[model samples]
Target: MDITRRRLLVLLPAAAVAWEFVRAGTPESAPNYKTSEHWWGMLIDITECIGCGSCVRACAQENDVPDGYYRTWIERYHVTDYAIERPQVESPNGGKEGFPMNEDSSGKNFFVPKLCNHCADSPCTQVCPVGATFVSPDGVVLVDKNYCLGCRYCVQACPYGCRFINPKTNTADKCSLCYHRITKGLTTACAEVCPTGARQLADLKNPKDPIHEYLRTHSVQILKPHMATGAKVFYNGMDGSVR
Candidate 1:
């Protein structure tokens, strides 16, 4: 073994033990108390959406999402007889005012909310070499930045392409379903600020929640349901072609 490198390696075990003891005393070690059975999800009503971008702004403001990065976004689609096209996708700064016009002769238009779906069998978690990316007991997918090696594997494995590597933190980041806020008994910023209630969050496991009610009453679809990751996000009145 190289002498210099070998000496450094020998000290690493002692350093790791000291680091763990220090971290254990910090506030971050606070117990993660919870009572939920599974991860909750939202049902977005596309028909009710006016292409308003309120959720986008709320998410940025609430999470301090970096410039050119989005934890949540809206996509506008114009469907026509000849073809379907996306007119506007992301306007990070503007809220409801950022909605784009269809400008198509077909006059068919709608908006869809896009975010991390927190799949039960998430490809992101599977590809993470370190245990940084993991599914919570309640089914929420999360990234422990402290453990993340910043390999960007989770970013590439995401089918929704929702994950992004944060330049500031040098770690993979994505929607946490507002894990910090939700755990505090507050609604997600996107759901809380959504005008017209187009986007709503609730527990799918709880049949009493409005999301479950909507699922029972309407034909809902998940993005790429055929992938069978058991995505919890539901889309109401979504065009089959969009999937």
Candidate 2:
């Protein structure tokens, strides 16, 4: 081989390009992934929650959520006797720093973690004028930031108060059930970080999923059944006072 200066220059650039591609890694591909084969949901055991706020912290860190905004959050409910219908709720700093000791002797207090319900008939998706927010075939709702108009319509349409405008993108954002991770066969950050195993990722289409057994054995309910949003998030041991 005759090594020349001109040949070295061309080889060096080609090698650099090849190295960059190698360093970037191959994009994950799932040839067998069938969206119809999956129906995503979440199971939350209210009784198992310790109000520790680990899930909230993990969600923020994983998603790069802006300060003063939350893709997921925890609410501390104080339901006093005889006033169960009007429970006082507080989520100071989205309960990321944990909650104060319950001082109210007359009421029962508990923590409830909140995120997108990923409803089958989500009002958020219904109100998107640009169709930027949509439910995936796998049942996870996602937002296409590039197509979003940032009109806040989805935010107003969501009954669960999940959607928020991202200051950096100027688009509506909410929990996607960690679609990026789920597609790669990983659980959501919140579920992964829950100390008490209170949060669980469920796949309705998977017959072997534990959610089926949990539903059979536990009395679970979705928030606001009256709306009939077809919400998939199931909560066990939820207090009647929780709104």
Candidate 3:
């Protein structure tokens, strides 16, 4: 059967150790979603991004994302002679950048970081019949590989088309925002690798965090605003017409 590839292609390793733990444990012990206090999110500053694709490389290295698949990617929108026609966008190195700069022509380029929106009312979790995917108490949406039946309903329902079934494990996967790394008192690999400070990881509960400050200062919008999934990912300076 020809499979519809709906997600980025990166060659990250399977979560062999983590999956073992998940399968061995009972689901009742899965952390309650309401009691957690912090909500993790990222603020993407389009103005600051240089289309360098450093974040993409960092995420792949840190998470072992598969060669063709990406946990995060950069979108470089290039406008050309065609006005009504859409801009050309490419994901070089799974969107880590390093493309030779094309001469400035009729095309104008802008860089936008892309990732799973991690919606509060995510359509992915809604389609999971076995309760494999769930929203964490801290508001980080994640998938329980143990409970996942390799059903691709979440992949089909996601508007951003960010979810993919792992080739090694045959389960749906996407950016967890480095949930394992974050819970261990470390920043996400992408955020850590961002050279221009374009990506900012913040605790939504922190009144003093810069994410709130950025939102207060900049014009921000989430991807597919009309979807109404209450997506947590926020993009500043995103062009409405561009995805």
Candidate 4:
């Protein structure tokens, strides 16, 4: 293992948090938390989203994302009923400032909030020459900025256009589903701050997680299913016109 990575491994088990004691059914003598027990993902409900930009704002605040770039963003789409024309999409300043009203009123409109799909067979991880980008045991794709070469291969490889060069750190950057918080047994900042509950953090491996019930009842779809990346962020009530 890389020496810097070894240091991170050592820190995770030693660092203490108050929430560690809050877990029920965990005896005082229980073993350390295992990453394999939890596989992280997200759920986005297109119908429930109001384009309020709360998730985008919360993500930026929690992650310290720089201006003119977004870790998560809302896109407004105006689509026609017929397959006659291309849909109009707008994401002003990555929708952090909310949106202007639609004047055309010719077709249905919806808000689509997008982030790193955290694909199981992630292209970003495959193209990283220095082993900086990788999928964790818990299924969250992460970037070890210390190991990144700023080569931008992963940036181009990501089909979702989620990856970007963090000018401040000079490394590839995208959402980790708030890995720092989720590993600590808390929900993601975006999911927690969403006023309408449009976005949700999902633990696919947990039998008790509500995501299992939701998935069973809803006709969920992953973005770009043909790419076959095993994209985990499932969308409910997604329209066919959405790209």
lDDT of candidates 1 onward, in order: 0.78, 0.91, 0.78, 0.91
lDDT of 1 by residue, 11-124 (tens): 899899999877656444543446465467777888888757788878888877887788888776656655554343434343335764445546466677888898989889
Instruction: State how far residue 39 of model 2 sits from its true place (Å).
Output: 0.4
Tell me each candidate's RMSD, in Å, in order.
14.3, 9.0, 16.5, 10.5
lDDT of 3 by residue, 145-229 (tens): 8778898999998898888888777888889988877666568888887888888887888687778877888888898888899
> Model 2: which residue pairs collide?
none
Candidate 1 residue-pair clash tally? 1
Candidate 4 structure lDDT: 0.91
Which consecutive 10 residues in model 3 have the weakest lDDT in total?
5-14
- Model 4 alpha-carbon drift over 4 Å, by segment: 1-32, 83-85
Where model 2 places Cα greater than 4 Å from the true spot, the runs are 1-31
- Residue 34 lDDT in candidate 1: 62
Residue-level lDDT for 192 in candidate 2: 98
Q: Using alpha carbons, what is the TM-score of model 2?
A: 0.87
* TM-score of each model, in listed order: 0.80, 0.87, 0.80, 0.87
Better-scoring candidate (lDDT), 3 or 4: 4
Candidate 4 lDDT, 201-230, residue by residue in tens: 999999999999999999999999999999
lDDT of 2 by residue, 1-243 (tens): 997999999999999999987775655743345688999999999989998999988998898999899988999998988888899999999999999887785778888988899999998899888889999999998999999999999999999999999999999999989887887778999999998999999999999999999999999999998999999999999999877
Once fitted onto the true fold, the runs of candidate 3 whose alpha carbons sit more than 4 angstroms away are 1-35, 81-85
